[model samples]
Target: MTQTGWTAGRSARALASLALCASVVTACGSASAAGRPVVLSYYNEPDSSPATQDAANACSAASHGAYRIVYNKLPSAADLQRQQLVRRLAAHDSSIDIMGLDVTWEAEFSEAGWILPWTGSEAQQVEADTLPGPLQTAMWNGKLVAVPQSSNTELLWYRSDLVPNPPATWGQMIADAVQLAKEGKPHYIEIQGAQYEGLTVWFNSLVASAGGSILNANSTAPSMGAPALKAMQIMSQLAHSPAADPSLSVQQEDQNRLAMEGGTAAFEINYPFVYPSMKSDNPALFKNFKWTTYPQVSTSLPLHSTLGGIDLTVSSYSKHAALARQAVLCLRDPANQLEAAVKGGLPPTLTSLYQNPAPEFVAMYPFYKDILQQLTTAAVRPKTPEYQAVSIYISHTLSPPGSISPASNLSSLTGQIRDALDQKGLIP
Candidate 1:
């Protein structure tokens, strides 16, 4: 089985056991919140396994017997966490006292009133500490609804030995790949272009590189135009190109392993988690690999990468909001952040914590500091309640090559999105 698949199986068994234990503990009529600690459950990605554990431990120490942590390790399904939240909301809307939300879900969860709003001192602190992309992502109609715990910035992972210098433009990237193909080396580039979230990431990156915004700044209309169409055309060309080694089936992790371990692709676009496995996966291969910022397309305007990250939030129905808030504060503390970074190589969210990362983290992921700067320039998807459906529109429209002509179809899609906004009274 794939590592992703294996992780999912293990998590299913673990959650089942935890559920039984939790039911037993609840059935025994545990002490009231006034006497016992306020407990909150959070769902997290498998890549964040160590971060969740370290964060929970830190929260426990900071809470000093005032709170406890419950983690739900999510499966590998594309929307597993989102679907789980909806299922939990249906059964008990307030059951999840504390939650973790992906930047993309800010709109849907906030609109559904599934997230609790931040207010007073905590609101100011969270806003002051968070990275702009994630901070903005956690907001809904100008209200701070969640705390950005950390951010995931996309970067280019390449075989330094294979391609000494990264390509500077889309044309250059293609040329580099073509050169590698001619040399009888493996494929040159591995991009996440599947029909899932990965596709959205690639799409956002391309649009940003082309100086096009995915959604209108006003958040009421699809902003796709000429630049966006150009980006789509670039992707279609890659998909249809005979010399291209990558297919539509590749995801981020798959691409990472293929480049880093299999020694096939010369470069892969992925997040920081892949760094941890490089040495163990193939020490010789890892020795020659390097991670760096996304190549500059238009240096005058920052090249945008899609923001992928998680935040800590409280359930709207939780009776433990006060306690959950306290725990969140603890999780955001610099000391805890440092500890988590040391334990898991999870990037620290607080700017101050960037001064000194773990030696191992620094050694394994030498591009850490550079990536921090890149994270600031990353872009979040449309931050409106209709974001999920909007994302669906984006994926469906862009997934297939030659499925629809971008120039014509995108105009029609824009009209359809504008109508959607008008129907909801967001725009005319």
Candidate 2:
């Protein structure tokens, strides 16, 4: 595998700074030196329920007085969570024992040595338990850098009562949507077209569904070619079509969901949370809703849903690395994952959970099989330390999708992606 010079230089600088911080704190020698119990601080984005806290409490009790787990909540936004963690880790804050990481962050965090690597029996167990796509997200440069705790993927949500059979391809969906619009029902399709992470996700899935990727196999350069152009062409056409939501350029996932629930759109692509949320907010609409695998870009190609969710990692700067690892393992236990799914609406990474879902998850059993299948086939965005830059380039360049022309913009898009990967024009 080839390493980028930019990443290497940054990693060296980060390590040097960490060394200085370590000297001041005696390298955070131990979690505890005296008889007092060691405290392990876990930092993660806040969850809606106390499932994570409950698991931490259970693990602490199970540790037999060895350590106590302290929860530190980060901002809800993924970017903010990453920013906060990066600042602390760069400073060598040993208090960050464990961290809840976004799946896309595994590559960056592992490459920069901000998180610990998993090996041996533990690695084998995690690999064996997690579904393939989610498991792959925790790996970086051929090593397991984290453990998949919960996993998510997009699904094609449709008004089943109106259209009994969902379309199999994007072309078909668009055609049906156009027909619906002509019938005086506008906004037939709801999608995340805003210039944000959601747009990147949508593009990733579209490219993958067309049997292409944003980067080559090694992930060191841009690989957006014909397939990518085709994906963009489809997106452009949809945005300019009569069936599109007028606010397409500004629509986020929540707005799309609300549009669908408000009886404005006939179809949407969103995460599983919408299922339960709709069930609670509008039972009548929820009853009419149904979901299936994300629509394929072509009839011959299989659909590729975009992956999302969290991973658990032991912070490389943690003083209590060993105990933190144990705590992470406990927190990711299948039982705890099941509880998180039941109470927090987070999907379990464990394959067994899909085979035999817990009672709490049974309420959505109608969609579980399809959800699990989509998770297994999900496509991940570029796994690079420069992913933030890449995402920004793609989202910004393709904003107000109607303005994009595959024929004229493909080369420019590829150039921009390469620039981002090379750290050119980066904000630092």
Candidate 3:
């Protein structure tokens, strides 16, 4: 193992200190345990991998022997479903006191009352200091229902050697790609086009950067027609460029990485989780690579990237809701969060931790200072039950072989979303 500032022994000592400090101080109010072991069902993404087991151990220890964790790591879309969430809740009423949910599921989970609102003062303090994008995600309508465990946002990853100064416009992106290709290097740009969650995020950033909104004002009418067509034109141009396949486009980040590290491509738009592996996969190739905030459409604005991460919430029916809440507090503690970040590749949600990371954190990733700045500018997707359907429809239709024209598909998707908003009485 490459040496890092943190190790199991150091983490244990730090956590032990936190446990002692927390044990003497009584909770503001004694939350009812309701007579059961607190279970935390987590729908973990791959970015938070490896440390999943360790995180469970830390939460268990920090809870002061108040809860037992039931951890779940579902790696794909099939694993994230309403039925699965419902089934788990039905199986054991007292169990699953806490859950780690996706950003998009915040509204659905809150509306269903699957998770109780996060109301403690300690939680509020955390939320108060949170960056806008992530804070918005933790809320449903006006209610603060969840707290971000560790959030991630996309950024531009490019070869510093090939292009010391990255492109700042769509025109520049194409010109640079052509220049790089002419120089006997690979293509210049890479993005997710797959018919999955990644596609929704990439598309959202593209449209937003073009100064377009998906849902209409009041979120009650179709608003995506023209902007989407414009966005599609940009993507279609990039697709036909020498770097990408005109006949087929890889729709995921993994493929993007292959193109990037193999020197098959000069640029990649991806997340920080890919950093460690990139270094391991080809140390020489990425030794001078750069991961920075994406260039904006205009010189003055920051490129808007979507916030993608999970939140920890409590089950309303959990027999051990109080203990579950405490478990969340334990996980959010600076020491534990920092440790998790170093070991798990989780970006710290706590601003203090993000600003002044532990030594281990700094050693694990030197570019965290840059990463934190980009994350602060991240934007949250609309949090409504309709968002899921909107995202799925947009992703499916934009990818080739779907019958709808880009403009037509976008118009129809927004219409369906508006109908959902009206159904919820969010708009008249």
Point to the candidate with the largest lDDT: 2
| lDDT on C-alpha atoms for all candidate structures | 0.71, 0.86, 0.68
lDDT tens digits, residue span 1-428, model 3? 32244367557756775675577555412422332335455445444455666666777866665575656655456335455666876565655566777788888778777886766695676586676777778887677888788778877778888888877766677778888888887665777877777877877776766677676544445466665676666766676677563323445878777767777677788888678878899898778677777655555545677777777788777776776677776766676667668887777777787676677888776778766776677656766666666676667666752233556666656666666666642322
Q: TM-score-based ranking, best first?
A: 2, 1, 3
**Superior by lDDT: candidate 1 or candidate 3:** 1
TM-score of decoy 2: 0.90
In candidate 3 the C-alpha lDDT for residue 34 amounts to 32
Is 2 or 3 the stronger prediction by lDDT?
2
lDDT, candidate 2, at 125:
83
Please state the error at residue 319 of candidate 2 in Å: 0.6
Q: Which digits, one per residue and each the tens of the lDDT, describe model 1 over residues 1-428? A: 34688589769956775676677786434433343456676566554446667777778766777888766676656478778877887676666777777788877787777786899988998888666766777888888998877677778878888788877666667777778878887655667665566777777778877788777887877787876787777777666653344454544556656555777777777777667677777888878878778765555656777787677788888887888888877776776666656565556677655556667657655787777777677767766777666666666666664354668767866766666656542321
Provide TM-scores for the models.
Answer: 0.84, 0.90, 0.81
Deviation of model 3 at 156, angstroms: 1.0
Model 1: residues >4 Å from true position, as ranges? 1-34, 46-50, 90-92, 249-252, 339-345, 358-360, 401-404, 419-428
